[model samples]
Target: MNSPLSPIDFEDKRLKIKFKLEKRLQKELQALTKDPPTGVKVDAESIYRNLSEWIVDIDGAPESLYEGEKFKLMFKFGSRYPFDSPQVMFIGENIPLHPHVYSNGHICLSILTDDWSPALSVQSVCLSVVSMLSSCKEKKRPPDNSFYVKTCSKNPKKTRWWYHGK
Candidate 1:
């Protein structure tokens, strides 16, 4: 008969998953460097050092409400990436003033939550964000931005976002 796995065994398994994730992320980083998606710039070194985190720069699309503005997105990945979605949020001082983007940088995008799919890649997410920004008709923060910012967790992923509208 076999005994139950110990806590140490779980830790070891987690470490192995992390290692695999690192390698996969490295490949993604290399691909991004070679042919980056439009409006997105990623720091390969930062990703290499810490495969679980990435900081990306996004240029606002021309003629869009956010034209001439720049924003930074922080992505935090777990060992179950590809199977799980990355915790992405706008960082830095210039968070976009969009109905879907909160004052605190928590983006209420369905793709990042309930609609997430393992098939989605970092580049795809960037494009989706760009598309979301481009489709906005007005430049304004969410109605409950202040309240959400004050009460939400530091990690946007922890919040249960209620996505509504287009």
Candidate 2:
């Protein structure tokens, strides 16, 4: 069991998940800070609750529909963080909907949902979301966005997604 005062050991499932996330986060920070993706910038990041949640600030892709946007996204690490999947979403105002995004900022991606696996890391999720934004050429949300927002079933991990097509 984890003591109140001592840091949880890596062997502990939750603590282990947290440690791996932190390590991945550090590596991503180093890579992005040195060579960030086009139109995406990292503003801030943090890990808390024995690594149960990670908060990251990102400047949206420039000149795109999401350009000039600042978003705060939260990644909720479950007990089965890697084995299962981390829940992620935008947690601030101005979370717009796109073909791949629900109004709630929950994303639609295989890696973060059905296709997720232990081999993937936090970096992949971030890149995928960013790529998702960059892929948007319409500069607008989907046509049936409102309906999808209301009726879409969340991923098995309880993530909401705006599926663009059947």
Please tell me which predicted candidate would have the highest TM-score against the true structure. Answer: 1
Off by over 4 Å in 2: 1-50, 151-156, 159-166
RMSD of each: 2.0, 6.3
| Candidate 2 residue lDDT tens string, 1-166 | 8556434443576676667767765665567657765544554443423345666666677666677777776777665656777887767886755666667566667777777888776667776777677678765565666876687555335644434443
> Each model's TM-score, in the order given?
0.89, 0.64
Q: Kindly report which residue stretches of model 1 are placed more than 4 angstroms away from their true locations once superposed.
A: 1-12
**What's the distance in Å from true for residue 125, model 2?**
0.6
RMSD of candidate 1 to the truth, in angstroms, is: 2.0
lDDT per residue for candidate 1 within 40-154, as digits (tens), equals 8998877788778899999999989888799999999976897899999999999999999998888999999889998887888988999999999989998888999889999
Lowest summed lDDT over 10 consecutive residues: which window, candidate 2?
42-51
Q: How many steric overlaps are in each model, in order?
A: 0, 0
